[model samples]
Target: MPILRRFQSRVKFFKASEYMQPKAEVQNLKHMRTSHLVEPNLVGKHTLHACKRLVERILTHKEEKAYKVGIVGTGGVGKTTLAQKIYNAENLKGAFSNQAWICVSRDYSDITLLKELLRNFGVHHEQGETLGELSSKLAAVVWGKSFFRVLDDVWEPEVWTNVLRTPLHAAAAGVILVTTRHDAVAHATGVEDPHQVDSMSAEVGWELLWKSMNISDERDVEDLRNIGLDIIRKCGGLPLAIKVTARVLATKDKTDNAWRKFINRSAWSVGNLPTELRGALYLSYDDLPHHLKQCFLYCALYPEDSTMSRDDLVMLWVAEGFIEEQHGQLLEETAEEYYYELIHRNLLQPDGIYFDHMRCKMHDLLRQLACYLSREEASQIILEN
Candidate 1:
């Protein structure tokens, strides 16, 4: 009886331990799911192909230097879209045991940024550490592991040299991919000839438009088709512009008059449309708030892609009679407010924001959009030109 009682107690103890084990395991899984996670989505075929080739090169050559792949193009040209696709590809998931995607916006703080990167690597450090110490912690975490790090929408080389590259270099076989709108940025990063992505083909553009419009058959309306082609041409092969216009057209019933109206409205701007990129950027410009509209249009006074000094731009704004002075606010301060507003809207890219922060010039597409709006708003000025 005593032996039997002991046996029964042992069985009860084992049963309790088994029941609690699953609960603890489930809680651990939930914790893991909530922490240091990345979710990826499909981009398109062309982008996926490019990504696969890059991953293969990285995996095949352990001794070879890590490749720095860059995607460069005008804004809204789908650089990020393509980069995301490559990052999320299922086949390439095993290439790197540890990967992180960091979006370096204009407002990235160095220490905070390092913490985010380390968190992805499953390294936890106390919050109030110095930038140097945080970088050291990050370096230690990535030391042995092969890392795939993507710095998306990089606007400055200083950020790369000072903050990201130092620690990232410690990781063996680490691949860094950058996406940007500027050629000089790629050059500054020492990438051997960044890949410049051009606008989609007209056929692809049309297909994208159809997808956006949710239209199945182009054959039902021949006249509409002709007008649509003309509109697509006006867009300058920009996917964004094509899709926006298609959405606009799609909402209206299929009719020759409706198609003609769109064509005619877009027709008068003929040669004014930017030649470098089809006018997909125009829609974004047209949607700007009034204050930003004035600020962007004011950029036309400067040369194309010419970097402009922040103080000089403000002084110019004061001299050109655009900004009105208010009590307790200098004209320079008012001008800066507008500059930041434009930057926030993705209308302006920061040149450098140090002791003497100087902002460079706008992209050709943005300049063109500004010019288009300026002409449309002040037709008399355009007519004189």
Candidate 2:
């Protein structure tokens, strides 16, 4: 009995030691499954090409100066998808010693949130410390190291300037990638010219729709293919709209009349569809003070994809009596100032050339959002016109 008891005690001691081992060392052994990593499903050649460019840039400058890559486009335009694909690509993964993916959601400035990012990088804090302490600890871990950090869905530029840039400044030769829907935010990052992710082409959009549908039928294949192409055209080459519409169509029985109806609906029109990219714009529109909403709605008078001269847009607003003139500033100049404010808020995009510099244009998606809000406010305008 005494000999058996001694052997049992030895076995229990070994088990406790094993359990107490550092988690970081055992992470691979315990989790070894690649399934644990959230791999983004990125489709289309455009996305793949962007990823290749990013990887090449990072490699080319790995030993030189730090590189920051900004992937900018409308929401649901596949910015995050492209960034993730590049981050997880086998070649890129092997090139960096440490890789961290952080999501900078709408409200990303909370210190606790920043600490969570550091934790993902395998840095832990002592109990009862503030975020500043944690930030310093993270700096120590990342500083002077070759690291790959991806800030996904970044909304506010200040968040990047304050939280990310500070720590990143310490990490020599590290690469930072930011994905944002706002060009102003990209500009604020002080990174090189952003790689813009535009909507997919018609061919690519149709291919994506086909994949998303998972359609397979010999008799109906021809009809379905035609419907898919038509539907893709209505999607304005936006991948999100294409995928969502395709999924919606897939559940319905395939029929010529049904497909035709789907293609003809104004709701599917590129200028009318409610897009995921427009959701943020809608929120901003909704939050606008009543007077501002009216002022913004007056912008729809401009043509789609057409450049609205800052002077012209403002003058129209003033002429239509949208702006209240103040002393010292000319009414046209005041109106231009208001237009600039809207530009700063991302309510309008630069049309590539203004009175010399670039002027402003609303994206099709944003224009649609503005029109929808306008219609909701004064249904009579759209109904009568």
lDDT of 1 by residue, 1-385 (tens): 2222222333355356432243212221111111121212222456556667765654665333345777799776767656666676676677787876776644345765677788788888774688899888888887877877777777887667888778877777777778888989877876666777677766566666656566667574444566666666767766556654664566466877776765665433545565543344564455455545666777654544445667866875665556767799988888888877665444565544234335544644577666665545555444556
Pairs that collide in candidate 1 are 235-278, 235-279, 236-278, 307-360, 307-361
| Candidate 2 runs further than 4 Å off | 1-42, 126-128, 217-221, 265-385
Candidate 2 lDDT score relative to the true structure: 0.61
Worst 10 residues of 2 by lDDT: 27-36
Worst 10 residues of 1 by lDDT: 28-37
Q: In angstroms, how far off is 156's CA in candidate 2?
A: 1.7
Model 2, span 1-385: residue lDDT tens:
2222222333354346532244322221121111112222346776777788888987887765347789998765767667767777778766776777765555344464456556767776566566577667777777777777787767788776776666656776677788888988888876678999998887788777766666656556666777767766666677656654654566456886787865655443234335553322344454454545655665554434344566656654675555666899887776776776565444664443234423565544566666665545455444556
**How many clashing residue pairs are found in candidate 2?**
7
